[model samples]
Target: MLVVKQALPCETVDFPLSSETQRFINICLGVPVGQGYGLTETCAGAAFSEWDDISVGRVGPPLPCCYVKLISWEEGGYRISDSPMPRGEVVIGGHSITKGYFNNEAKTNEVYKVDERGIRWFYTGDIGQFHPDGCVEIIDRKKDIVKLQHGEYVSLGKVESALQTSNYVDNIMVYADPFHSYCVALVVPPHQALEKWAQNSGISYKDIEELCHNDQAIKEVQQSLSKAAKAARLEKFEIPAKIILLPEPWTPESGLVTAALKLKREQLKAKFKDDLNKLYQ
Candidate 1:
């Protein structure tokens, strides 16, 4: 017999969680899982979604111990004057905030600020939008953005996050080249999902590597990617024009990702230089 832990009424996530992932988790666990937004500098208590909010992608209003502010970044096209919702770089000020990084004055001076009222503020590089309900939703980041040949900027992190919600995708790394008009992706397909897809399509494959090279398999994965991107309302240029499927999972041991599972972009780009060239071709 198998045993399972009792489902609690509420669960919380600290890292970025997609709306689709959150909904799926809520359905699977039979509990309301809310997302919280905060950094280590804020003592991890900036804002949290209410369990009953029922809306996706909100990190709730600012907590009593902290206050949240948004300032415009013109280069990124985010502004406090954005209609319907205000969007800008999220700054947190409160009693519980950290002073600065230990013995890193230059780095500390870049992000930490003191207001005229003697209140301390930390300039979180995370881009956010404040909804009418006063809740904050993380929309982008200050880094990991690329400009395409057409001069339009795309946020690589946002694209990856949206596409990773696809059932066929275990992980994804989106690449953009300034010389190329379109973006391309390197996707790590879920083994079980790809196997099931192959079976359903009446395709025989000796291994995952062979299957990844199959034209039909590649087409299906691309279709899945396009569907997810459209569902997420990504702009037309933001959608990848091509993709390279990797049979192997990127791991910390592989040096493609950090211990925290964050992508090491430079390493990945270097490792797949030839593949990326082919993609552009």
Candidate 2:
């Protein structure tokens, strides 16, 4: 009796719970679920815990069967460690560890290395920190932390999550460029929802683009976003400074979004750099 919602590649009337219309039985439905972090090289399921308010972004404590540690990466290689440190790449070892990559000794040797204690540990590229409560909070991918000109870093995941909560926002991709002062969102509104709102508000639109430019429609969308921001407890920097409604939705085939639904920040920035600049100007 579990109801699971899986991320989808395209819009669907009733979203599938697994791979391309495939459905899998989810044990933690209606009940709170736990999140875990690991990699293929680590044999997966490195750490997890029961769902809790404090564990929102946490991957929970290390598993009983496995040993986990955070190692600092220097220019050439990794630094050894044992004690629970704040933040770094996650390394796993013990009974659950995988032997090595198949027929790829070079790649295998690079990720699976032994520590001073002669224990084999698989290096997971994901970046995270040990929480004060002994859980692990995944901040972002090692590469996704965008440093702004003002020396502040923004988590693109956080901003994207906030935008996704807007009812009118069907899909969105956000990015900031070296030349821009703030981030911009390429938004695709829910056309049905927008049409209903417009009709009720007595507003007429020649097309989707015109609807987006309508003052009242814009106000409604903005208000929805403002409310969603508060509800999501988004930080000031994690909210987009401005949004541009796109004529069509971004799709994998279009190369606007990745198969995992993550925005290709570099590609998007390059494609819309001019539009983003216009916003600031």
Candidate 3:
């Protein structure tokens, strides 16, 4: 079994890689990889890592063809202009961005706005933070922002990203109960890793459903998830208060995710209404 691979310093120009992926490349290839960032609307050319910097979580500065701005979001109660690092939802302008959505005037008008400068800015729906050195760090998606009962905003995507840093977790979905004070999760643990863990920890379960219901497994999962959340610096409210292990992979065919693997929120809620409801109770 032989494998042919590209040598050190992979040629990645118009595509952005995650910081985690970047780290893995650095370890395996022993050289930094080029990185880039953009949205589908912009033809995937907003920014790139020309410096070949292996710095984790940096997507570099905006491209010359794009005009990037971070505006204050009043509803979230946090303003980028008010912050020193300038964290806010990423807004873009320039010829690269589309004029508006096709045949959907109302939807287009909602996200596309012309500023006083006469530049049409499209709300990217992605949150990012400005670094001192001018690099952009993508935090999470704006759609994942959820408001807690205490008026605190929680980014479920960010929480999920944090929890996924654990090896035992294969996939996760964090759900915020708007009607309640805390959060919950639909967890998909790595099958082999979980089984090995159960054996080592002196726990017993015959199947995925039984494993999900195992008290010891649940306790470990909860603790590890909480630890990961804390490491990601998420607020207490953003952490899940309870979790329902599904132990099944979600695919586009499963009606839970899109072809791009983006979660379909409505479909998931409808599909797992019972599991979600049980968590609240």
Highest-lDDT candidate: 1
Give TM-scores for every candidate, taking all chains together and pairing residue i with residue i: 0.85, 0.67, 0.87
Query: What is candidate 1's lDDT per residue for 1-281, written digit by digit as tens?
Result: 43348876554544677677778767766668788888999998799888777777788889889889999999889999999899999999978889999999999999999999989999999999999889999889888788889889999999998898789898899999989899999999999999998999899999999999999999999999999999999999999999989999999999999887989999999999999899999
- Two-way TM-score contest, 1 vs 3, winner: 3
Candidate 1: C-alpha RMSD to true structure equals: 3.0
Which candidate wins on TM-score? 3
- List ranges where model 1 is wrong by over 4 Å: 1-7, 21-30, 199-206
Cα lDDT, model 1, residue 112:
95
Ranking by lDDT: 1, 3, 2
Flag clash pairs in model 2: none
Query: How does model 1 score by TM-score?
Result: 0.85
What are the per-residue Cα lDDT tens digits for candidate 3 across 29-134?
6777766678777767776665667787677788999988887676765468755788888888888888888899999999998889888788888877888877
Looking at candidate 3, what is the lDDT of residue 18?
60
Candidate 3, position 141, lDDT: 76
lDDT of 2 at 182: 67
lDDT to native, each model:
0.90, 0.67, 0.80
39 Cα displacement, candidate 1 (Å)? 0.9
